[model samples]
Target chain A: MRTLTVELGERSYPIYIGQGLLQNIASFFEKHQITKKSPLFIITDTHVAPHYLNDVETNLHKAGYTVISAVVESGEQSKSLAVYEQMMTKAIEAGLDRSSTVIALGGGVVGDLAGFVAATYMRGVRFVQIPTTILAHDSSVGGKVAVNHPLAKNMIGVFHQPVMVLYDTSTLQTLPIREVRAGLAEMVKHGLIWDEAFARWCDQHAEDLLALDPETLAYGLEKGCSIKAQIVSRDERENDLRAILNLGHTLGHAIEATAGYGEFLHGEAISIGMAGAALLAVQLGADPSLYTETKRILERFGLPTVMPKHLDTDQVMNAMMHDKKFKEGNMVYIVPKAIGQVYIDTNMKVSAVRNMVERLKEGDIHV
Target chain B: MRTLTVELGERSYPIYIGQGLLQNIASFFEKHQITKKSPLFIITDTHVAPHYLNDVETNLHKAGYTVISAVVESGEQSKSLAVYEQMMTKAIEAGLDRSSTVIALGGGVVGDLAGFVAATYMRGVRFVQIPTTILAHDSSVGGKVAVNHPLAKNMIGVFHQPVMVLYDTSTLQTLPIREVRAGLAEMVKHGLIWDEAFARWCDQHAEDLLALDPETLAYGLEKGCSIKAQIVSRDERENDLRAILNLGHTLGHAIEATAGYGEFLHGEAISIGMAGAALLAVQLGADPSLYTETKRILERFGLPTVMPKHLDTDQVMNAMMHDKKFKEGNMVYIVPKAIGQVYIDTNMKVSAVRNMVERLKEGDIHV
Candidate 1:
């Protein structure tokens, strides 16, 4: 197993990446001292459980670990307050306590929802993340666990780090084509924002990475998680350096909210957001070549590089105005200066953003 | 104002205790660097808004602050998931941003509900606690913000500290007799668990404390807050010393849940929990005199020293078993050995608890 540690002082934990580490999940728990006399609660979803839950239960039971499971329906809807309330109910009914552990075994939705349940259950509890999707490579690493509000995405949550993130890449073998493509967007983002060499490497091996070559995918996951871990360590609460992680998130979140969630995957929306942000950067006097390169690389990975046709500038603008990044009426954008470099710009003119959105809405950017 | 710093490193904040500080709320905000150009969202309740909301808003406005108000109903019902969702919607509608401040201007319910809203709104925002009740002296000092779940009290929440706790003692004068008595339960708990001198002082001055004598109440508030702050500083997440703060809360929460939230005041429920805890301690070979003294002091303050008639031993036991503090089928009780000293006993036998409850239910202890 290739392990990368997110150094967060006492709150630090490791991200384990390999093809079939789920079979050895017991040792990870043992090494992390997560052993409890009480039965550990396995929080998964309907879809994931049908594939891996019984295998995990058998492995854990073989290790003499009693498990209580809270399985919800498989989707973003499970991340609601109502579902969260149900998770709590199931957990308590299963008799999980402070001494008990919670293992979140699913994709981003399960990770975010279960991590949040751990964060607030009796103030807090110990939990491990066993991410089953490529998108979870991003969500499971950071301690930002939240559920969506009807009004906003990830509108409610906390920064509760997991004891460990066991990323069994074998699970990715079953991920749908669309999900794999979605995950690559964030991986590409990590490289673009922090490592030019890594970004170039990803560009060279795009096909292999997309085809799920275990070694190539593992290398990319490590690079992405390492960068995220470093950023989160320095600013766990996103005070300054951490805000860079939101490079495309400002406009990205706006698109998702406007289009309505599930219409576009998180990373898919973020791909389009990265394009808008690059344009914003060029307008702010950054090199235009970087925008071209970013769009090229995103397109190579089968991610969208242009705004959706139906989403008008007005809808996008209205959503952007309410974004969490927009503080005190100022739109904050994490603009890319060049590959491997980005800076936060708070002085973006609304008219310029409007102009870019209007052009993108009318397919004028290509012209 | 008498200020006590909570000393939580970067998360450290001050507890300002005095009369008439609400009129100078702007100074407190400035001093804590919670200055925001955006309008402050003042979250108050119907009961508290009439008396102090206008005064606080007018003063803030006079000091060149813009304000938005969200008035919730006055009670535990306001600490629901539905209410939390509404709070989020209202804050968003009010255009609260990362730069905006949330001022919780009521008692514990307001502090918990609003503080939680601040904890999760846009990830988080700076919040100040303008406590209008004596019970808030405990809730506001510690950063344990939460909204209650239908299944449990305070089952969902986070440890988000406020920039400052502006405890305006002047608001206590308007407190009803029942509310005043309720608030004293927590104050007496702080004394009983940590300081013998404070406990003795409380015992001697129970009448004065209940009458809302400004000097005595202020002294008690400062002492109670200091002890809580010290404990919270050492263990912010209740890993160890902090769990002691849950002294009577295990059964206290259980009682509240069993009786229905609003049926029994929080402090009233805790009052009985404290009595039960003392009895359990005596049974466990602690000083019998301690239990007698503890029950006598609680009686002097007009706090309940017996279980409510409607709640039988079975109901209390069932609730306690599901308490967040229970671990591995073992009920964990923070048992007081004497005034000013307590130890966590996690190996209590269920039958012993059952026996104690049976005796208490039959009024056999007094006989």
Candidate 2:
């Protein structure tokens, strides 16, 4: 097992990356002093519940922890306020209290939803993130937890850190190939924004990383979480440095929302977004070679390199305007200056972004 | 204007108490440097929108703020997650962003729902509390904002303090008499938990305060807020001292939920809850005089001295058992020790609580 700690003052917690760690959750609970005296609410989705819920319940039960499970539908729609309220009701019916802890036992949707429930339930409670997707390597580390609104993505939420994150790489074995391909985009993002050497390492090992090789996948996840933890620790509320973590997310979120949620997996949209960001970065005087490298690596992972044809450029622009990153009607782009380096460009004109989208549509953004 | 700061480190904010402060909101904005470049979303309910929303919008517009209004129906039902989601949609449609601010312009329900929206919007934004109800004197200051869950009250929410609470005493003059009577219970609670003298003052001036005597009402509200702010500063997450603020709220919330939200104004249910707590406190070896004084003061304020006949004792107990305060199958009661002192009793048996509830229903308890 490899351990990395996200240092967020008193809110800091550890991320444990390994294979088959789910079987050993009993010891983790004991070490953390989460006792059976206080109940445990295991929040999962239908997709994950059938496969791994019993495994977790068995382990926790063996550790003398009384556990209750709250399962929602397995998709982005489960992150709505209606589902959030329902989950709270179930947790209460399960007799959860301030002392009781919540464990999120699925992919990013479950983590985001359950994490949010823990964040607001009783004004915050302790929760653990057992992220089952590579995408969650990014979501699980930072304390940012939210649910989407029908009009916008992640519009209602708060920053609540988890007590710990137990990443069992073995869970990757059951993911569909398409999901694996999508989730890897966030790992690529971690590299593009902060670590040139790690970006190179990811490119070289892309095949092995995608194959779910335990050691390689675990190493990549640990590195991704480490970068995320460092960034979050410094800029917990995204005043400055934290915004860099949002490198591809600005355009990515807009594309995802425009394509309609679930039309493009978050990472798939982000992969395309990173390409657009690269184009924007090139306009900001970045070395054109960086754009080439980012696109090449993303394509090698089978992620989208351009915006979907069905999505309207004008609609994408409108969605971008609603992004939390927009300030004073100006869209702030996190453009890459080089591999592993990005800068915020708030002075960019809307005409220019529209032109970039037009170029993307025409397959003309290539340097 | 009298200003009291809820010192929560970087999250600290001021509470301004005076008459007609709403008219001088432009100056307050200028002093606080809440620039007009950022948009403002004034969230008000139908009841308050008709009375004061225009005044606030006009003041903000005069200060150069580009203002937008999102109005919901007035009452407790508007505090549902459904309403919360709808409010987020409206705020987004209004083009609110990181620089934008939300102003809650109504009673406790509006303050709570709007405050929660501010707390979670874009992971939080600046919001000022323009409380227009006497009950808001308590809700506005502590920043305990939330909506209701069908299963429980305040089941889905968080603690996000406001940037400022601007209490315009003049707004109280427009409140219906029943509401004014109901709201005073929180002030009485503030006095009971931390300030014996304030309790006496509230009892002596009950008539004048109920009559909207600005001097008496403002004085009581300010003192109540000072005590609450101090308690909140010391324990932001309710580890210990902050739980004392839940005085009368355990049974109170259960009673409220049991009767159905909007059936009893919060203060009315809390009045009955305080009576129950007083009885429990006496059984726990408190001075019997504490119960006598509690009943007398509640009577002076016209607050309910017994549970509503329609509410079932069994249902209220079941609701209390699910309270966030319960731990390991034990309900922790914040029983009053005296006029200004209270202690947490986690070992209290349900039979004892049931006995107290029966006494409350039968109107047989006496000092």
Candidate 3:
């Protein structure tokens, strides 16, 4: 097993990355000192519950922890106030208290929803993340947790770090190929934002990663989590360095919201958004190769490099207007300066972002 | 204005207490470094809007600030997820961005609801608390913001402090006498837990406070806020010392929930709970004078010292089981150890609490 810690001073926590760690989950609970006397609330989606809920519940029960499970529908739609309220109902009915731990047992959607619940339940409680998707390698590492607003993405949320994250790479084998391909988008984002060699490593290992090769997947995930942890440790609240993590997210969130969430996976939207950022970098006098290489690597992972042409550019721009990055007539964007590094642009013009979104829909943003 | 700072290290903020400070609201905004570039979203309830909304908006407008306001129904019911979702929708529609400030321009209900919106909106924005009621002098200082779950009070919440709290004592004149009496519950509570002199002062000046005597109210409010700020500085998330502030909240929340939110003002329920705590303390071998004095003071303020006989003790107990203070077969209660001091009883038996509840309902909890 390989472990990396997100160094948040007193709030710091560890990310455990390995194969088949779920089989030995009980010992990890003891190691982490998560109290067994309080009722445990496990939040998983329908997609993940059928596969792992029984094992997780039985193991905790065997460890003498009272267990209650809430299974939400599996999608971005599940990240709504209605579902969130229902989950709270289940938790209250099951008697979750201040000391109880809320465990996210699915992918990014479950992690975000469950984390938000933990962040607010009893004015904050301990949270545990068990990432069952490759995409969560990046999300589960950061303390940012949120739910989508009908008019915007991730509009309601808070920064609540988890006590620990357990990633069993064996779970990757159960993912559909499409989700696996989409998940690589965030893995690549970690590289695009800070690590040049890791970006190249991802490019070289694309075939192995796509085939669910456990060793390759585990290594890539650990590296992605490390880069994310390093960034979050430096800027826990996205005031400065952490904004770099949102490289593709500004435009990416708009695209995902425009597609009504499920139509385009978050990673796929981010993939296109990253291509746009790379293109904007070239427009700002970055070497045109920056745009070409980002596109090439994304395509190699089978992520869509173009936004859907049918979606209105104006609608996407309107969605961007509601994003956290959009300030007074400008966007606070993380634009690529190079393959391995990025810089934040506090005054990216609205007209320029509109043009970039227009070009992305047309698939003509190539350098 | 007398200012008390809740010294929370980097997150510390001031509570400004005085008469008619709302007239100079714009200057406080400038003094506090609240930005004017982004649209400001002010959340006030219907009860407060007709009285002060236009003045607040016009004052900001005169200062070159753009402002929007949402008026919710006035009462505890407004602190529901449904209402919370509506407020978020309004804030989003009003174009509130990352740098925009959300102002809670009402009492504790609005503060908790709006503070919650600010805490979660865009994963949090700047928040300001403009308190208009005596109850808020206590709540506005600490950053415990939340919306009540259907099953229990404050079942969903997070501790996100405000940048500053503005208390305008002149607004107290508009409060109904019942509310004024109820508000005294917290003021007296501060004395009960931390300052014996303040508690006796509240008892002595109950008539003046009930009549909206501005000088007495302001001095009392400042003292109360100072106590709250001091305690919050020591324990921000209720770990040890801070739980003392919840002196009557455990049973108070249960009785309030049993009555349904609007049937009893929060302070009224807390008054009965505080009396019950005094009774419990005497039952545990404290001087009988403690119980007599607690009841005498509560009655002088016109606060209900006995729980409603109609309320089912079992129903209140069940509601309490869903509270944050509930643990495995016991409760973590903030019991009155003596006048001006309190202690947390982490292993208080369930049966003893049940007996106390029965006695409270019967008006026979004399030591």
Candidate 4:
């Protein structure tokens, strides 16, 4: 078992990663002092519920913990105001109180939605993040839980950290092939933005990660979570340095919103956006190798490197304008300077970004 | 203007209490470094918009600020998921970004709804509280912003503090007589929970307060805001000392929810809950004067001292069970030991509290 703490003083919590942790979930709850008095609420999606819900429920019940679970649909569309309210209804009906804990037991969609519910339920409650998909290796660690607005992704949320994060690698064994490919987008992002060596390691270990090789996958999850935990610890509220994590998110979220969510997974949209960032970096006088290096990595993972031609550049720009990162008339674009490093260019012009996004939409090629 | 700071270190903000401050809102905006480049979104309800919205907008515009306004229907019903979604729609439509400011320009309902929108819009933005009702003296000071669920009040929200609280007493003159009375309930509660002399002052000056006597009301607002600021500074998240601030809110919220939200104003419902708490205190072997004295003062302000006879005890009990306060089959009741002091009782029985609530409904002998 490997453990990483997010170090948010008084609000800090541990992330436990290993095999079969879900089967021993009761012991983790006890170790963390999550109260057994108030009924526990487990929020999972349809895909995850079918596989692990019974194991978790039976184990918790045997250990004298009262468990209540609600399962939603299995995609980004479920991260909406309607679903959020539905989750709140289930929580209130289940008699969950301040002491009750909400456990997120699926991929990124489930983790974000459940974490958001835990953040605002009764003005905040205890939350446990149990990521079942590789993509959640990033989302699950940051404590940036939110529901998407119709116009934008993650438009409504709070910086609500979890009491603990329990990641069982056993769950990753069940991920679909495409989900596995899409999930590696963020693991690759951690390297692109901060660690050059890890970027190289990902390039070398791409086949193993895709095959769900236990040792390789676990090491990647640890490295990804550790980088995220370190960044979130320094700037929990994203006032300064944390914005670097949004390297590909600006255009990535725009692509998702314009494509009408669920057409492409979150990591897939982000993969395209990261590709756009690299191109924009080259246009902004950064080395062309930066763009080549980023695209190479994303493609090696079988992720999308180009935004589809059908999605209009103007519509995507409009979506970017509505994002939290866009302030005043300027887009807070994150530009990659090297494969392992990025910088926040707070004054990126709309025209410059538009020209780069247009290049991606038009499939301007460089190998 | 009289000022009191909420003393939360970097999150600290000032509460400005006086007349005509709204007319000079641009100066306050500049004083607090509310940017002029990003547009400002002011959320007001129908009741407040007619009298003050144009004045605030015109002044801000004249001072070179881009102002956008959204007027919601008045009262507690506006604090719902539907209304919250609508407000977010307006925010996005108006092109509000992370650097933009959200000004809540009404009473508690507007403060809560707008503050909530500000708290989560693009994962939060700068917020200013421009309170226009007496009830806001309490709600505006604390950063507890939320929209209510069908089953519970403030069941969905966060602790997002504002850049400043700008309270212009001039707006209070337009408040309906009932709102004046309802607003005094919290002011009286601040006294009941922390300061004895303030309680006596409220009792002695009830007539003056009801008449909106400037000197009396101003003194009371300053005192109420000061006590609230101190308590919030000590415990921002309601982990321990902050729960004391919910002295009457446990039953207060249940009464509000069971009555279907708009039927009773927040302060009025809390008024009846305060009366019930006094009755419960006496039942728990505290002095009978605590009940008599508390009831007498609430009545003097024309606040409801008894729950309606028609509202079923079982339904109210069920609603209380859904509250953030009730937990582990126990009611976390706040009992008054005297007119001035209170202690949190963590282990009170649900059945025992059901009896007290039944007493409130049956209108048992008192006074």
TM-score of every candidate: 0.96, 0.97, 0.98, 0.97
- lDDT tens digits, residues A154-272, model 1? 87887889999999999989888998999899998898888889889989999999999998999989888898888888889887788888878877887888887778888898988
Question: Which lDDT value does model 4 have at A264?
Answer: 85
lDDT of 2 by residue, B1-367 (tens): 8899999999899999999899999888788878687788888898888888888888778778899988999888899988888788888988899888888999999899988999999889988898899899889877788888888888778988888888989988989988998888999899999988888889899999988888888888899999999999999878878889888898999998888888888889889999999988787677888888899899998888887767888899999988878877877888998888888887888999988888888665665
lDDT of 3 by residue, A1-367 (tens): 9999999999999999998899989899899998888889999999999999999899889988899999999999999988889889898888888889999999999999999999999888889999999998988988889988899988999999999999998888999999999899999999998999999999999999999898899899999999999999999988888888988888889888887889999999999999999888888789999999999999999998887898888889889888877765467888998889999999988888887777777666556
Residue A211's C-alpha lDDT in candidate 3?
A: 96
Candidate achieving higher lDDT, 1 or 2: 2
| lDDT per residue (tens digit) for residues A199-315 in model 4 | 999999999999999999999999999988889899998888999999899999998999899888888999999999999989888888888878888999999988899999899
| Higher-scoring candidate on DockQ, 3 or 4 | 4
Task: Give the number of the best model, judged by TM-score.
Answer: 3
Sorting all predicted structures by lDDT, with the top scorer first, yields 4, 3, 2, 1
Please, what are the lDDT tens digits per residue for candidate 4 over residues B214-317? 98899999999999999999998888887888878889888888888889988899999998998898888988889888988999998988888878889998
Best by lDDT: 4
Comparing 2 and 3 on lDDT, the stronger one: 3
RMSD per model, one decimal: 1.8, 1.6, 1.4, 1.6
Model 4 regions lying over 4 Å from their true place: A362-364, B362-367
Query: In order, what lDDT does every prediction score?
Result: 0.85, 0.87, 0.89, 0.90
**RMSD to the native, candidate 3?**
1.4
lDDT of 3 by residue, B225-327 (tens): 9998899888898888888888888889998898889999999999999998887888778898888898899899988988798899889888878888776
How many clashes does each candidate structure show, in the order listed?
Answer: 0, 0, 0, 0
